[model samples]
Target: MAFALRSLLLLCGISGLLTGVWSDLKVVRVPSCPKGWSRLDDRCFLVVDKLQTFADAESSCQGLGANLASIRSAVEDEVVSALIARFASTGYVWIGYNDINVEGTFEWTDGSPSVFEDFDGAPPTNPGEDCVQTYPETLSTWDDVDCDTPSPFVCAKDLH
Candidate 1:
């Protein structure tokens, strides 16, 4: 009986390690053109890189059958940020968040903003950067950046 318990514990540990490894390896996935999509965690996004301007990129996302990726939680925010950092997007992209409402407050098109934030120790710099962008963590994870600069944006959806 003890041997069996030990074996079971070992198996569970191995499974946990494998799961971590899998997540580490496949941090981001971009769907193929025409029919491919990128997936992070339980959400998926489509990227159309050929366009210029945040509006153009947004329209491009809509044309591809997806809206700009919206981060709702810290995890999703981290993931999106990672994607941006991996691709080295220095500017800003039109994320799902825009202050089209007031001028300072931002909300995702999904109707809510992710509780995540990327300010190191200070709040955002300018209200003009009211739009949202994603930045990466130590490796690559989503952190909020200004959306007005025109970095490549990510569009994501739940796989219902």
Candidate 2:
């Protein structure tokens, strides 16, 4: 009886191990972003070399099947800032935050709630400044600028 029980337990263990390995093998690998784009945290980002107005930048990104990059966390901000630092001619780059819908409340282009903000000097105090850009002096911080200001921008797309 003891020998049978031991054999049954071993068989169960082997079966479980095989099942785990099979599941792992079935997992699909995610492809990397296309050339000239960087992959970070399941998102692909591309920095536009040419400068454009905030609205124009957004439109350009849409044409590429992406939207203006949105920074939702400090780590994401750091990643984007590094990318911009490498490619951006101007210190600042346009992001996806804007207060066009409501004067004081900023929202991401994707319509998601704004949970993170890294304002450089002060928050967007002026009413006319509706668009947001990275502060070149402090790459990690942000500043609200006029939507018509021309600047290079980052475009982001999900990898999923």
Every model: Cα RMSD to truth: 12.8, 6.2
Give candidate 1's TM-score.
Answer: 0.57
Error of 1 at 129 (Å): 2.9
TM-score of each: 0.57, 0.79
Quote model 2's TM-score: 0.79
Give the total clashing residue pairs for model 1.
Answer: 19
List candidate 1 segments past 4 Å from native: 1-35, 87-92, 121-125, 137-148
Q: What value does the lDDT take at residue 22 in candidate 2?
A: 88
lDDT for each residue of candidate 1 in 17-128, tens digit (9 for 90 to 100): 9999988884566444334565766667654444355566667667766677776666766656655655543634456766656765656666654575454444454655
Per the 3 Å backbone cut-off, how many clashing residue pairs does candidate 2 have? 0
